[model samples]
Target: MRLSIPIQSHYYERKRIMRLFEAKNLTKKYDKTVLDHLDFSINEGEVVGVIGVSGCGKSTLARLVSGIEKPSSGSLLYQGKPVDFKKGRKDIQLILQNSIESFSPRMKIRVFLYEPYHYFYHLHKNEALDCIKKILKQVGMDESCLEKYPHELSGGQLQRIAIARALIIHPRLLICDEITSSLDHVVQREIIELLKKFVEKNHISILFISHDLSLVHEFCHQVLVLNNGKIIEKGTIQQLYKSENEVVQNLLKAAYLNS
Candidate 1:
């Protein structure tokens, strides 16, 4: 299914003006609240970063936005309408942190990369191979990678392939949940650079969820600081630096110390 936003009468005008995705009072709960009345938006071609401590609902928010899990009592809108998670939108893709675990053990990298193309675009085998080759190269991988299994590759290589898989569908919004948490600083920097190039070239938005304040500061145009399921602070990196909130201040201090 090649998922697409239905063209409205004023599609071009709306495209120029409206947010690509928006969450209004989005809340999720299990036995207890995971996310509480969260509100955020992503404009076209912009990168918005979400930062919080562990269990602060960062992953939950990503799930809600990408339709992996629905919000318990709030709304998620894509192009100003309620998103149907059951229908599965191809334009919103989520890349999880565990790249190795995300793939099937028995499947080759070829199958991992090809399945999305087959499912979404229904491309011919040759066409799919061509597309996969192009995407892998974009992520700085080569054709030989297609013959390998997930475990055969390094963490950085697997993560790059994971990103390649997400990009196959040409998503409007890429929700990255702790994507750099497991990698070393050097690999993390490379991945961030790749993402920066991808976002710019494709003209898409990103909802980047990370605990690394330094990475977020370097990549995102705006930042949201979540605490206890609520947005404790939000603004551009410069604005965040000027924040008087204790939580934001402490996070900045930690990021600076680590740097």
Candidate 2:
């Protein structure tokens, strides 16, 4: 006798712009592997938190997904198709923690914002400047920032400006690699709130990478726990909080109970 299992009708109801299947086994060095084997899926418009220890390769995984770094031997499928680094999808963008280094020391801040449009949309100088001003305003940065250099701004301001540049392109998948780690707690909260608002309004998918599990819990719908490049645990925010894994338990304790 054969038996058929029933499927939930609503399981396939939601729409997704991109999905990462497996995302496994990224071996950086033969002797000391960075990511042993990892797995997670991010639905469109979902905020996926990546939480792990300092050396667990959380940022490395973000780079891999953004095509900034190549995985040694693992497959990453974006929208069910394999990720091709050489011919990368233009809709993906990465916001690194140290936004200062990401910018050119010689260029003005406005150039940083307009350059992407000049490449992708062929917008003229005046049009690009207007677009840049609009995005900078959206991120709570003043027009005066457009004339300043990276050295002229504070760490928090630079980070916000960097985020504005990333959002200016209206990317579908935004990879944030510890983007607010250096900011003050107040600024951090504000930045997170701004990003959340953008995601809600634009339907953008976010892979937020951070070592702070508490922050992740407050922001993401689902969380992926990484240690030495392996996914020790992964589930919804509630499930992760109630997880029994020692590393996760300890991290949560340190962030909340211990602190």
Candidate 3:
């Protein structure tokens, strides 16, 4: 017999009032400090872009938020509570730049996509296959690709599969760490457009990390500029364009020239 799951009214209420994810004084250090005390938050369904020059702690911040690395000092809260990366929370998902490295070469694409569903939802084989087919279709992949190994696919195709893997778990917040840096301009634009549609349709929030300021300006609702591990500037694209900060100005100039 199928069971009916009652929706939690408080979930919607919290979505209206609380941030999907929040970081307060988030710091990470190794031999040297990588990320300083950083403060940022993303509301439900908001796309927040993080941009900085190389070595500005952009990837470090993504690691901290995604729970790949622990913070030395600071707090990360998801849904108004402390984030427990160890618990394997499905609400937060992180997609990395190297999709091929993330997968097992020995395994077929179907295994990569099916494992999450089986583990998280305990679905039967047919059920898992159905879910996988749906997600693959949404990501513009066909069934033939499912039988291929990771090495058999192109970079853009693997990246889309990685995205489908993340979305299969139904995450509330998605952290993308330079996911498009490896792709060409056309592929990057396609991925960004796909993410925009996914975010709008599912009401999911994204923390997009990229060095491409032009892409960030086009895609993000708000932009955070990180310098020396701290947020040096943050604003909407228009507000940032009007700012006089040297760092922001330099980035804007670079972006303009690149475009």
Candidate 4:
């Protein structure tokens, strides 16, 4: 018998590693199981929306994917290797759901935005400040934001700052766990557009966890419906509309009706 290794003619070992989420009997229990044996994959550069009622483990999945919480019993892989949060800490960033709680009241926006660069780039103060200015503009924030504390900013400004911090590392995957839930409708739309633009220009994949089905429909390419810690349905946006599953159909109907 002959054993052969497939050789790639165009292999670049240093290419930006692809992000992946794999689960084999992945389960989480907080009093009761919050996530059942869940098996799903989100390809690089695709947006995967997790939509469901509150307490359906949507945020739990976000936590697991972002390495904030370990699964009770299963394996997770990123770029085909076993996930080690310590090793890949900067590559995956999660923007928490609550903006007010995400940032420190004492930290000015400049410190919030530049701290990551200082830590990651080891840049002198000047270089870090320059990069911080550039990034703030990229995120649609003005230089005035640099002087304001988290408490002094509106909810939307704080949310943008949170997102800017996440992007400071240029992460390969962004796990937004209902980050827009607290903002007003117009603000939510702006933030969503900003996120979409980021994804288009960069190859970052996103797992957007939300309870708002309409918002999910507007932004996500694929939707996963979670109920009672289980995924009841998963499909493309078009497929979601055509789904016969009662939960998904009802959710779609309600979204459309409300719209």
RMSD of 2: 7.3
Residue 196 of model 3 has an lDDT of 82
Error of 4 at 247 (Å): 1.4
Residue pairs in collision within model 4? none
Task: Tell me how far the alpha carbon of residue 235 in candidate 4 is from the true structure, in angstroms, after superposition.
Answer: 1.1
Between the candidate structures 1 and 2, which one is better when assessed by lDDT? 1
Better of 2 and 3 by TM-score: 3
What is the lDDT, from 0 to 100, of the residue 83 in candidate 3?
93
How far does residue 65 in candidate 4 sit from its true spot (Å)? Answer: 1.0
Error of 1 at 215 (Å): 0.9
lDDT of 1 by residue, 156-234 (tens): 9999999999999888889999998899989998999899898768878899998887788778878899999999998
| Candidate 1 global lDDT | 0.85
lDDT tens digits, residue span 1-259, model 2: 1111212123235654455433645555446788775667777777888987788888778878888777778678776878665655557789988899999998999888888888878999898888887888788989998899999999889998888878877777899999988887788878988887887788788899987655676678778888877888887666876888899888777667532
Tens-digit per-residue lDDT, 1-259, candidate 3: 2112222223334435447788999999989998889998898887889988899998888888888888999999987889987674688899999999999999999999998899889998788998899889998899999899999998999999999999999989999999998999889988988898887689899999998876777678778999988898887766788989999899888777776
Model 2 CA deviation exceeding 4 Å by range: 1-27, 257-259
CA error at residue 128 for candidate 2, angstroms = 1.0
Candidate 3: C-alpha RMSD after superposition: 7.9
Error of 1 at 137 (Å): 0.7
Q: After superposition, how far is residue 165 of candidate 2 from its true place, in Å?
A: 1.2
